[model samples]
Target: MDVSNAFLHGHLEGQVFYQQPTSFIDSAHPDHLTFRSTLSDASLFVYRQGSTTAYLLLYVDDIILTASTADLLRQLTDRLRAEFALKDLGPLHYFLGIEVVRRADGFFLHQRNYAHELLDRAGMLNCKPAATPVDTEAKLSTTDGTLASDASSYRSIVGALQYLTLTRPELQYHSAGVPPYARLT
Candidate 1:
């Protein structure tokens, strides 16, 4: 599920000065001042029941809630709705770029779509599949090759690959040693 305008719900701590949006100006509180609140801790809230537990993971505006039973899940959802405006997206299939597939054994998480998009962006969509993502024995040195013309793209792809490591541990072993600015040799 997703929260509508999640950032706006964040409570400012201390003194915050800002001109209210013209459209949202309140005539009653023209000189409105936001005060510190305990809302920031809402991102992660967990509930436990004996051997069972319910987990709520919040990333900015997106929220993923899971529980061992349907009744518990429903109770949590209702409580959340009461506190904030939430749009229930129903079952979890796609989140961030990870695709979740439920199986008899358990839930499987993959990032095929995200990987495809990354490959396309790198103009490697049609590239041949490699037996391994990187060469283990290849030695990369700073003085080995000329610098890439667009270092930003290289850094961007590396950053994306770092995120891809969430579902691809193999990539982590290969990429963990590569610095963001390391040029191809």
Candidate 2:
């Protein structure tokens, strides 16, 4: 469980100005009105108390959190609720096409959905599944006059393969043409 608007809950000092709400535009002080924008994606604020720590993952309006203490998490949740309207999504699930499965042994993260989506986007969804991405016996070369017509698509496939490495660590060696850790063997 995590606080829903944890970023907005912070005490903001100094004067900030923003356009008035569309419905409640004040005619008198419209020039001096303000609103607070959420924190940026690359920045995050964390709080720790004793053995527990709360992480505030801020990506615009969306937030994800993990805390050691349940009571502290609830307290943070209530505080955030009082300050701003928030939607609490209980437990972690799918995020960015990555499926997170929690089990008694450990957690498993997979990008099967993401892989399927990438295949669809690249128009390879209906194509037959190849036995391997690359053949170890054959060396690929661009100098053979096989210029890539769609460089962007090639790049996209490369990016997808890079993402796959997050869970499929073994793919790294194969992508780099290192046969030692190839997925085949």
Candidate 3:
């Protein structure tokens, strides 16, 4: 779900003042009820009461909500709509570069489009696919390979891959090897 002017939904505490942006105006709106977040991830908020349970994932102004039941989902959406301007984006297909494919038994999530864009940006879309992205047995060293002529491009790709780790955790192991080479540039 997309929140319209989501930033405007925050409640300012105490005396908060800042130079307004171009054509900005002070407006007030009630924020959502307090939801508990786990220690592992602050962005994921869980709301549970009696037999009803709902999970709310907050990423910047975007929100992804799911419930234990269809009725609960409607109730949750209605409650949120009462407090904030929410535009339901319909079924979840893509968010934050990750694509979600809903199946009869489960949801399949992948970053194929994101990874494709990353490779396309890196000019390696035609590169052959390997069994593994990195050689797990190989030792890594910054000075092993020649310095990257385009260090900025290399850094940008590395950063994008770091975000990709959200789904492709296996890349994280090989990830460390790339950063060390960044300094070599």
lDDT for each candidate structure? 0.72, 0.63, 0.77
Score candidate 2 by lDDT. 0.63
> Worst 10-residue stretch by lDDT in candidate 2?
176-185
For this target, which candidate reaches the highest lDDT against the unseen true structure?
3
User: For residues 44-142, what per-residue lDDT tens digits would candidate 3 score against the true structure?
Assistant: 988786798889999988999998999989988999998788999998999998788989999987777788789899898887655456667998897
Taking all chains together, each candidate's TM-score versus the true structure is 0.63, 0.54, 0.67
| Model 1 score (lDDT) | 0.72
Query: How does residue 33 of candidate 2 score in lDDT?
Result: 20
Residue-level error in angstroms, candidate 1, position 27: 30
Candidate 2 C-alpha error for residue 116, in Å: 1.3
Local accuracy of candidate 2 as per-residue lDDT tens digits, 116-185: 7777877767775443555669976767767668999889887876767765776554434343222322
Candidate 2 similarity to native, TM-score? 0.54
* Model 3 score (lDDT): 0.77
Q: For model 1, how does the per-residue alpha-carbon lDDT over 1-185 read when each residue is reduced to its tens digit?
A: 99987787578789988763424646786743222212445456566766766878778789898888888788778877987899999889999888899899999877777888898988887776554556789999999989977999989988897787755665544445453222111
